[model samples]
Target: MTNLQKAVILITGASGGFGQELTRQLLEAGSRLILTDINEAVLRQRVAAIQNEVKTGEVLACLASDLADVQGCETLYHQVKALDIPIDILINNAGVGLFGRMDEIPRQRWEYLMQVNLMTPMRLSALFVPDMIEHQKGHIVNISSLAGWCAIAGMAHYSASKFGLRGFSEGLFNEVKDYNVKVTAVYPFFSRTPILQSERFGTLAKTYQGLPEHMITDPADVMRATIQGIVKNQLHVFPDPTANRLHLLQRYFPQLVYWINNRMGRSMKHG
Candidate 1:
């Protein structure tokens, strides 16, 4: 099992709902943390709060850097490198969501989403993997979503980004397994997180309206399962029960899953 105590972890998107929850839990587990977010004030506030609550683990650094561009990624890497801390784990939890028909969504918005959700993780991994390989130990966690496994309407761009993340995580896991490095791709269904509060387009909000209240998972529960998955070195994690069941169905009954999603897509369009 991976020991989080004293482990130095770098978490992107540290100001978001899921990111904050993960930070809380990992800090409680006695892991040193480096938190990064685009919002400098918010990130500092979060670090201060965690410091107040948990006294065991150190909050090494709180960085405010955009992950939506290559330059931002490079800046963060250089900043962390300057600190001289060897990250034992890297959590690529930063992402953005775009909701609308493929044609209706602005090209720039979806492009930004892809950059933040897909390219940022790849870039960050490229920066840290070499050290992890040299040390022969580390873990990388990528927060993907259920949309990656089962695509639906009004989420064409969002789903594509998540799909790309999952694919990259899987490939990276295989590539680095021999070095004793673990990679986990977390696939959570809709969660009660700030991502849900992101601006919606067209009928996308209407589509979410159709989902049952119980369908939205809790951020804390998802983070708990995510931590467990990290400790056990699981390659793929379905943090919510619905996500796990959906993954099983997608595996055993691909056509059925496709048909169900197709029907849901039609409902979203008609309503």
Candidate 2:
């Protein structure tokens, strides 16, 4: 409903590429952070890095749990509750991108991708939304992708999950705006995050072609734009200028989008 003062924010995938940047920026902005990741050692190391190098904020808690699992979500919720901290912001940014044709991807891998990208966010939002409604204030930031709006070959599962996340964010925005709970869906273009290097469906693939300079977004810029959006209560945050334009183009001229996508697909295939 209003700007958060000394907000207690919980971020999932704290050790992730964007997660680390988000934590640093939030600390700079003076938020009491609660961070979690499936990788415990990496999580602890990152927490230490932030606390040692950055201005210390309120309780900086880190925990380990596989958010892709339902029980893991329950365990994480309980652990945070035990801390007895009120949550003012929930960032569901832990996600994976898989590159493979629909039939080429294993069912198990697709399920895991869906759970991490879609189900975990949905579950956590369900857990925390009631509290936000009771307090009549909170922020939900879902880190979706540009793939949500435009289709790309070999990214069927990834695109589906983001599409679901985007739809969820929009519906939640309309559902909770009257209650003063703000929801922001972020659609970021390709970033230089480790996700791009991850092995998908058995092998690694360079799904896009561009210099690292041009292909990846600066994490700091994404964080700045996202926090600004939250403070301004913006419904959508397009972290890249190119991504924003693509979204506009898709909305007004979908046929043009398909034409461009076809050309890009050819380039990727030929390259």
Candidate 3:
């Protein structure tokens, strides 16, 4: 189990919906943070806004870097390494949302999505894992989604990227165990995050608007569970109760999930 108190943690996408809340909680847990995001201005803004709560969590560095491409990830890695700080925890929390049919969304966009969601984490992990192995202790928490467990309408490519992340994270967990390095893949269903307002293309926007209030979760609840899981060195975390139910259903009754997706997708395709 990793003790977060005074642990050096580097979090990507530190300016987004999930990133911001996770940052606050990590800070409150007494973890020193190295926060990064693609947008420099927004990153700075977020760090400033959270200053009041930083008494417990030290802000080591607020470097801004894009993770959408290999170069970006490489440069960010180098920047962090140059700081001469060893990271105890690496949170690959940065990701974007794409909503549309395969043909409706441009191929390049999915390519970008793949880079940010799957390959960027893979690249960053490759860059940082050796150091953790050498240190003989570290944790890597990947924020995946429930969509990774099952396909979803208007998000086929998104699901693919998450599925890839889940597989890679789980594999890394095993490979790095002997070295005392840990990996956890977190799957959260839709919550009240900005991702819910993600850009849509040929999509039925009302589908999310129509979801029962109980089905969507509170982001705080998800992150709290994630933090608790991190402390236990848990491998897979289904943070939301509803999402947990869906995960089990997806595992045992996949056809039902697929059918639900198909029904929603038809509306996105035709509505």
Q: Whose lDDT is greatest here?
A: 1
lDDT of each: 0.89, 0.83, 0.87
Task: List model 1 lDDT by residue over 25-77, tens digit each.
Answer: 99899999999999989999877886788777778899999988889999999
Task: State residue 149's C-alpha deviation in candidate 2, in Å.
Answer: 0.9
Q: Which regions of candidate 1 fall more than 4 Å away from where they truly are?
A: 203-210, 262-271
TM-score versus the correct structure, for each prediction: 0.94, 0.93, 0.93
Tens-place lDDT per residue, model 3, 170-215, is: 8999899999999999999888888876676664444434345565
In candidate 3, which residue pairs clash? none
Cα lDDT, model 3, residue 188: 94
* C-alpha positional error of residue 200 in candidate 2 after TM-score superposition, expressed in Å: 3.2
Which of 1 and 3 is ahead in TM-score?
Answer: 1
What's the TM for model 1?
Answer: 0.94
lDDT of 1: 0.89
Total residue pair clashes for candidate 1: 0
2 versus 3: better lDDT goes to: 3
